[model samples]
Structure formats: C-alpha cells, structure tokens
Target: MIVATVQGNEKGGKHITVKDGVKIFGKEQQEYINNIYDKFHINRIEIIGDFGIKKIKSKEWFCYMKHPEVDASGRTGIAFIVWDKNTEDDTIEKTIREIGFRDEDYIKFNKEYNKIKKGKSNKKKQLIFLVGLGMGLAAGLIVITLSMIKK
Candidate 1:
C-alpha cells in the first residue's frame, strides 16, 4: 500500500515526463518514496529506476499516475504516482478517485478503510454479545442451583 505524491514548486517546471520528472526531482524522488513509507503502513516499496525504467521487483503491485495540477490550457501539469503491493485494487482506485493524492488521499483512504471495517466490527459486536449472554446464563444457573440447594 505504497502511496506517494510529488510536486515541483519550481516555476515553469510543472509539466514533465516521468523520466524528466524524476530528473527534475533528483534527491527529492527518494525523499518522496521515504515519505510515503513513513506516511503509510504498506507491505513493501522499491523504486525500479528513473528514465524509462519500468522494472518492478514485487509480485503483486499496482501503480496509479495522475495529474491534477494543470494550467488553463491543460498543456502544463504535474504528475504523481501511487504504488501499492498488498492493498486491494478497489480500495486504491476508490481512494484515488474520491480524494486523489497527497493529503486528500490520506483522508479519503482512512474514511474508506473505516467504512470497509464496519463489517468486521459488526461481527465483533455479535461475538461480544454472545459471550456476555453465555456468562450471564451461567451466572443465573449457578444462582438457581445454590438457591435450590438451600431450599
């Protein structure tokens, strides 16, 4: 579940190819990957390389690249990549579609994850209720036996 977003604040350097983007980013690229690791609890993440390098080392992985930053003419834009190996594709797609990358992505992912977790929570609640009911029944049975013995 490696999700990363990078922005080049340099003026007139907005739109660029991934290869050119990596060059423009330079050390910042690694910093971005590191930041993603720090930000998310993903299974694994590794940078294949820059400049037309598409070598992936993971067996199950997904990548989403999008450009939300664009000029009026839509000619210039900044692109970011979100990579993940362990997370579900639907989860990733929903997150990207609903909130996009960067801070927005984080918030949306948390929200969606919580929603998906609701099913498990219901099951937990049912288990807790059953345990409590069994305990109460046993306590009642013990009280009845003790009272009957006294009688």
Candidate 2:
C-alpha cells in the first residue's frame, strides 16, 4: 500500500517520494504510474479535475489529478494525489468527486482488473483439472489390479 503526490507541467513530473507519502522504487514506479495515467487517458483530457482507479504492479491505486486555477495569462500546472485502493474507500470516494468519474470508468477499470484475475484463474483451473484426472486414472488402475488378483 502507498500514497503520494507529484507536480508536473507539459514536460512531465518528478520522482515520487515518502514526503508525498509513498516510497516506490526507481524506474518501476514511474512505469506503473505512467500505465495508470495511460489507462485513464489523462493527457488527452482538458479539464480542471479527474480521477481514476487502476492496478499498478498487481496493486490497485486511486489517482486524482487537477490543474490549479490560474489567471488567463498564467500557465496551468498539474498536481496528482494517489493512494492504495484498499484503504479508506469511503474517503477516496468522496475525494475523487472533486475531480470526476463516471459509471463507465468503473466498468472499464473492473473489466481490466477482472481480465487479469481471470488469467490467473485459468492456471488454477488447469491445475485442478490435471489433479482430478490423475486421481481418477489412479483409481481406475487400482480397481483393475484388484479384480485381476481375484481371478
């Protein structure tokens, strides 16, 4: 579980640190965060606020980003606050509203997460099926051997 904040402009942001509330490792942190940003299409959208939920490195994260209000002549900068999805569900729900979310976004995120879950489930299903088949075969061989001995 982790939480953090970062500031960015058109170029990009900086290293996320404990000061922001999370201690993510080197390049891996940047990669996963970028993935989350991509999944939500953050860069393409032009608005004051937005938020989303997605998995990063097998863990779910809640990200809320917004551009601070500025005068017409001033440049707008982006700020992001992120946290582990497992904790404070009610709190995060209330917080993201300051940004925005739609039922479709939830559906999309869940669809992606379930795909990952389903992939892992397929492996388990195969293992269970193999085990069951092996047991059935073993029982059949035992029954044949016993009947032969009776003869």
Candidate 3:
C-alpha cells in the first residue's frame, strides 16, 4: 500500500491500502514514515511549505501526508484542510466527497480551483501577463536589431 507519513492530527495524507499483501513501504521505510509522523504528531515539525521552517527543529517534510486531510463531516460539517507555506488545499467539498487524489473529478476540481485562485482578478496574476509582455518586447527588439545589422 502506498501510504504517506502524517502527523496524528493532520488531515489530508497520501495513503493507499492494498487488499491482501501489498507493502509499498517496508519495515524500515514504514519506520521512517512513522518517525516523521511521530515528530509531527508531537508538533515537533513545521508545515509542508510554510516559511520559518529553518527555525524549527523538525520542519514537517511531507513525502506526502504531513498535513491533516480530515473529513469532519460525521461530526457535523465537512471540513477538509491541507496546509503549507502559502499553498493549501482548502475547499469545502460537502456535496461531493471523494477519497484520495486518484479520482479524476478531484483532479479536475483542483485544476479549476487553482485557476480560480490564481485568476487575473488578483495582483499576483498580473505578473504572468507582464512577463509575457516583456518577453515579447525583448524578442521584437532582438529581431529589429538583427534586421538592421543584416542591412
């Protein structure tokens, strides 16, 4: 089974269980996964991509897992959160709930979500267009210079 290491309280972790006998991570590997998990479990590590990771003794290194992928729907509300530095998979998927990232719809949802999150409505998005414009201008200038040189 492909199971990722995660803190005890963490929610979204990459895990896949097998039917009979399938060990993606063996004893030593599982131990390693557990070690990191234990650290995070005791709150000894930092988040996935959070800043100030250097300051902490154990910066939460996620081979996947690390973050808390929890479905608190049974308790009442469907709350799923995955945190990182400036990145997080936070979308209250109440109506349609699916397990694992292997799902096609989940992938599509994430793609759309990211697109919406990084849409042109935000200031950060303008950088992409600006960079494209700069590249075009530079290329045009280079072509003009080349043509003049040819003459």
Q: Which candidate achieves the best lDDT against the true structure? A: 2
Question: Order of all candidates by TM-score, from best down to worst?
Answer: 2, 1, 3
**For model 2, how does the per-residue alpha-carbon lDDT over 19-123 read when each residue is reduced to its tens digit?**
133345667667656754664474443334453333444445444443443334465433344455465644443333323334564444346545755777798
Ranking by lDDT: 2, 1, 3
lDDT of each: 0.46, 0.50, 0.38
Cα deviation at 88, candidate 1, in Å, is 19
Tens digits of per-residue lDDT, candidate 3, 27-129, equal 6545645554564556544444311221113222222221224443322111122223333343222211322333554455456555644562575668878
* Model 3, CA-based lDDT: 0.38
Q: TM-score: which candidate is best?
A: 2
- Residue 105 error, candidate 1, Å: 13
Question: Residue pairs in steric clash, candidate 2?
Answer: none
Please give the lDDT score at residue 73 for candidate 3.
38
> What's the distance in Å from true for residue 41, model 1?
9.6
The per-prediction CA RMSD against the true structure, in angstroms, equals 12.1, 9.2, 11.3
The backbone clash count of each candidate, in order, is 0, 0, 9
